[model samples]
Target chain A: MNDTNSVVSIKDVKKAFGKNVVLDGINLEVSRGQVVVICGRSGSGKSTLLRCIDQLESIDSGEIRAAGHLMGFKEFNTKLVPLKDAAIAKQQRDIGMVFQNFNLFPHVSVLENIMLAPMKILKRKKSEVENEALALLERVGLPDKKNAYPRQLSGGQQQRIAIARALAMKPKLMLFDEPTSALDPEMISEVLDVMIDLSKAGMTMIVVTHEMGFARAAADRVILMHDAKIVEDAAPRDFFEKPRSEHTRLFLSKILQH
Target chain B: MSWSWPYFFDYMNNGLMLRGVWVTIWLSIISMTIGLGLGIFAALMKMYGNPAVRFISEFYIWLFRGTPILIQLVIIYTGLPQLGIRFNVIESCILGLALNEGAYLAEIIRSGIMSVDKGQEDASRAVGMNWRERMWLVILPQATRTIIPPLGNQFNGMLKTTSLCSVISMQELMRSAQMIAQIEFRVLEAYCIAALWYLLLVSIWGLIQTRIEAHYEKPFGSQEAVSNSEK
Candidate 1:
């Protein structure tokens, strides 16, 4: 399935731990340079699907291919060999993931947090990384907070810094897992605005969030997941206006109520 | 009679007592270093290692902590020789102190590492750092703030525990005083002088410890003192 058109593709992906099934026979295709937002109720395998894309969570069955690299167990002469942690990390570097909790390294300053990946993994020079980090911070409108610790920043600012930290790796695809779910209601817009800017800049992004307004306004394709499967996948206008699945419709109505 | 100032000064200047003080200082320093290194390793093993490693570390801590330090010292100094594992007086003293100190320090360090928020490790991994890098750069530095006060207390305890080495005839400060008292038949004067010397040394260490703690307390600064105005 060497389709150059799609940046990420999943075929019949299934993930389970013992008897607890998390993602069941999931199939997803993310096109190049398209912003896709995934929405689902809790335990719908939305975040799990995103994690599988980055190979943070391995799939039990099926194949995952991202940026032309095959995920899951690698085949070796009819035997399967799991990739080592370093190999998986190298693959994940191309797909930056922003966590729901704004997992900023609390010991580091905002600038160091952004510069760490490029400096350590990418092995860029300190001055070069610092300059790039400053530019990213400026773009996110937190250049003045370059030296502030994550604890010193508000939740919105921390998430924005997290976004900037991800961008420092210069990843081809960005994964955001409930990026604003932990933020205050008032502080959510600042993080959303930064993501909106990234979308406008044509960065390929897959965001798992309940922010229906963001899904409607910024997403090129909005996907609704239910029971470990993608129940509805369509353009934002169609998915929100005319959801076919009862689960999708019910989720929308509940989320869009207030 | 009240304390004699001239006699105290004369005792302080005695070569044997001065040498004993030096021995005590060096012994504490070496033992503390060994204890700290072992403590940190034990703590990490308890927290992050596999179950086998955790079990071994737990048993070590339990065995050392559950028993009395005096008994532990005796076991190291006296019992080991019975098994044909003989060490010199200083060596036995250091071994006893380090083992006992490591056990207590292990608990202190383990609690310190645990006190750090779990999010820090997750954050480090999210940034593409592997486990070793994450532990060294992120988790341990945050753990240092919590570990230091207890570590300081352990140091103080270890300093006093050096007196236990007198039983093994190590000729440390207490033993030196015993020897002098036996020769001069001045039990009160000799013991009083030894007490004053120990007090002097501990007081000096107290000052140094306060400075060390203060140094760590300052945020994002070099070791060089700028001015007293801020204080």
Candidate 2:
């Protein structure tokens, strides 16, 4: 279904790395302000789907549309031609992504890291971008750590600053690729709390995470992927209590065991 | 023939030795500038260019790095003249030193670029940075920290390597020493003065390299924050 209001629409998208099939005929949709949580076994394409949506990983076949724009390509005479890197980058202006590693530039400070994209890519005015960056650092609860470098800050703080960096672009949709996977156990909740605040305030997010508490608290729908296909998609309450697919049931048992 | 401090001071204070110092400094500076230009292009070609371009760049690095620079200097200066493709003594020296320096710098640069976490490139793309923007603004900025110390070593090495140009009779520091030695017959004193000059120049560069490394590391908050990459 090509819904007019959908922020992201993936149609039978398939991706492979050489001979290994990564995403096999994945079909999904996310509406504006929807929080979709995806969890699965490591090779089940949970993170690949997020990368595909971001166009960092090219799909072998099928199409992904983000914010009504066809991703990574231009449509000419019913033929799909891959767009130039600049064109693809322009199309990605509305998408913000936070990687698992935080990836804060070590050469710049935290405030500069948050200010860089809006000032460079979007060409926003420097003073305005600086104000917004400061406000975002405050929002993420690290206003005083503006001058600190990524190596100086703890993992949780770095991830929070990464989120602030992404939001400085004022993107329409945000993608989180297991944002907390690299953090210490005690630090996970700090990053999750920022994400939960974003969810409560109506941000469109697609998160690949194993945090079931986050899923139950902030997710609109929970999806389970098995062998590169999304095998189960249901409301959190329904999926947690009455999972339909045996794969998801087994998956939840394994995760919840801890 | 006896050791004399007055004779040594006289040799060191001459205008001829001053000109020799100028020639050595200018030769090294120009060669380094050319080497840096060639090195950046060669590194990018090898890492990101198509197969054909990559092969060409690889062969260029291989040809230069595989041979002694003195032999290359002789070939360019003496051998090419016989083939009717003549370069002046100065041009020949620059061509030889720059090509050899570029090859080593290329490998140093490529490794520095490779050492960056792949996630940095992904993060740049996620923020809508194009390939060139990411390379210049993001990747190179981070790669430079890893690239600098080795680059400093390369620069100091390049300074000393200019001595080889004397074999081509380009009249740099060593050539001047030879000329002064043969004429004045103060062989020991003239060569000793040249040795002292070389040592002083290298020591000055070492101090400057340390300052540059400290400046680049300032953003990281501590020297340990940006760990030293292998030389």
Candidate 3:
């Protein structure tokens, strides 16, 4: 990817917790409006990398730049000052994250859940936010369940509401951390359909998922991570067909077998 | 030897017994309010505060829980006098009752807070709520449902515990009963009156508890009943 067109840039990112090293010297770049899929076996730090981008997980060392703003490190007194929790939250509002668990507020209705961030963080007028929230809910095909609590919705519908809640913030980039991994097998396709439509709309997204079909169909580029490093990064067709790394070939072989 | 209804009214007519009931209600309300406030703070400190704060909270719980409430009352009301901290009988009784009750209330509040799902915290954080905001808006609201039943139990226990204050000449229910028995030499009548008053107060509190529990119960449905019934 050309350096100038990149919206997210990570360089030499290293993170460790006590004796366990999670991400070791990782580097990646994503251009504006591109869907990049990250796939790896469990414990390969795929989720940690996405978390680091949102500053949810602090990095031990490195730099990350998103939409021209430096993230993951705070500068103070000629040295980097660790960003406070509130400051990190302010930055995170610009990039919404969707979790595998669908993490909806159980007590609030679907409408309230979607409107909460916009009302609380953006201080948007409730009527205008409700209008926008209704539109997003309609888009997700859950207009009928607007007043229903999360427990009342199916896993597929809950995940769709989660997607709409993220979209309510109008984030420049969206991160999905195994969004479909926790769904029931039958519910997976509904969420994937929503994501496929989102990608077609040119929404910039970084997705950490094991769904090969989603990678093959929707991802503009696919990145394969192993042992805390990216072993292969290429267009989906080439990465699957002509994987240069032995690790990539083995990974593709194993995943394709299933 | 038979039950004497006229003697019960006679005991009620005694100014000392009537005053004792007033004093008993006053002590219960004040001590319970203080206990509930301290309980909430201790619970928050134990659950969400830093190591030092949590350590202090744990130490407070340990110190009070390790000792008997009667012993605590004696220490506060009697022992402190030797150190020149000469609080009046009412102040001493309320302080002793509040401090002892606060420890038990803290445990109740902490358990209530813990019962909330961790996912709720993550959901709140995902929406960019800070720790204080998350605790105040999300965790505490849900915790209220968990806390009410135990809080009702605590208030009932506090009503009984107020009897301990009579040891320090506080002239509350039991103390007034002792005075009336001494004057009229009607030991059975005065003591019976005090017992009846205690029962009546506790039963009334039980009614209020039922109402408060029901109010908080609406959002939670039967989940709380299943958990609390087991407890």
Candidate 4:
């Protein structure tokens, strides 16, 4: 999994809650500007793996490196110890994440949501951050929604604002955890369009989604997870046309039926 | 059996009674403001501090809330002087009221902060905000929506509770009423005037509370419409 150009490296990552295993011995490498889509059944570890990469969920054993630094641990006396909150926060600045729910701050206008992290955490100049935030809003095709509250917008529009908010940090990598899973069926395409544009602009991304169309259209590699392990990993063409694993075949059948 | 309308009117217009009402208003305003600050501090300590810090806050809240405010006032104004510790009348009244008010408000504030969605926390953390930034900028603003209604109710109670300080000879509204009653033998009229003042003060606060609540509600949009659209 070691690669000089890799933006993210996961080796033998294992995570569990109580008695239930969520991610088991996962190994992956995401190179710079690579668009990776991981698809699986509901209980598969795809989402958890994405969360682990962002240090939102801690791994029980093994290592995860992102943006040229350890994810959640700092080397102390040649032994790995968990970093403090401040250090962890510094690491998180480089890796942006979007949840299934938009999770925008309901109390603020959309523009403030985009401006807050850069201004407060990074201590950037207000005028500079405000300009970048407006640009990001324009990038997400919501330039007109600067003053709108999150609750006032439709779910799809809110998700776009969430994407703009994440982009305001100018992160090295982005992780999307079911970005469109909560939207109405008709609203899914608008959010996906923004993601596809992001992928085209050469931002490193790892997406967890059930949208096979998106996987085939924009992904460099498609991965199938089953029973807490990655069962299949292949280029999009081979993954859809000629999957190697029996689990991939059955999973594909179930999802592709409709 | 003998209630005099003329005496009631005279007491209501009395300069002493008017000053007493002013004192009561000042006491409520100052104590409630200080109590709110203490409540926020204590609640944060109980929620996020280490075990020792948590125990200190827990004990403060328990001691203040469990005891009667009147006894606490008496102890501060009268009893403490026997041990070479003394506070004047005004200071003791305010200290007792604020400590008691803080204990109750701590619980109210804690519950309000807890009611905020866990997702809000996750989002704030994802943005690389430190604990202080997250609490102050993100969590507290949202928690305030839930905190306001109960906070208003607490202030309303505080307006009336200042009467207890009269026992400590603080010369607030109730004390003035009692003095007038004793001197003029117009107990009914004097007390009635005080009651009317209390009713008037509480009514004004109720209106202001409604306005503040409405202002906070604006960012979240109407509750009914949000729920319907979300569904």
Please give the RMSD of candidate 4 to the true structure.
2.8
> Lowest summed lDDT over 10 consecutive residues: which window, candidate 2 chain A?
A1-10
Flag the better candidate by DockQ, 2 or 4. 2
**TM-score for each predicted model, relative to the true structure:** 0.88, 0.94, 0.86, 0.94
Candidate 4 lDDT over A1-258, as tens digits, reads 467889999899998988899988999989999999999999898988988887777899999999888989988898999987778778888888899998999998899999999998999999999999999989999998897779888899999999998888888999999999999999999999999999999999999999998998899999999989999999999999899999999998999898
lDDT of 3 at B12: 74
What DockQ do you compute for every candidate structure?
0.31, 0.54, 0.29, 0.52
Give TM-scores of the second chain, every candidate.
0.89, 0.93, 0.90, 0.94
lDDT of 2 at B115: 88
iRMS values for every prediction: 4.9, 2.6, 3.8, 2.6
Reference contacts preserved by each model: 0.30, 0.73, 0.27, 0.56
Q: Is candidate 3 or candidate 4 better by TM-score?
A: 4
**Cα lDDT tens digits for candidate 1, A1-258:** 667878888899898878878888988888888999999989899988887887767788888887666764667998768887667667767777888898787656788889988997788999999999999999999998887767667899989999999899888889999999998899999999999999999888999998888988899999988888899999999998887889888998898787
For TM-score, the strongest prediction is 4
Model 4 segments beyond 4 Å from truth? A1-4, B223-231
Ranking by TM-score: 4, 2, 1, 3
The deviation in Å at residue B214 for candidate 2 is 2.5
By DockQ thresholds, what CAPRI class is model 2? medium
Q: Identify the runs in model 2 with alpha carbons over 4 angstroms from their true place.
A: B79-86, B219-231
lDDT of 2 by residue, B143-201 (tens): 88889999989988888899899998988888888888898699899989999989988
Highest DockQ: give the candidate number. Answer: 2
Q: Each model's number of backbone clashes?
A: 0, 0, 1, 0
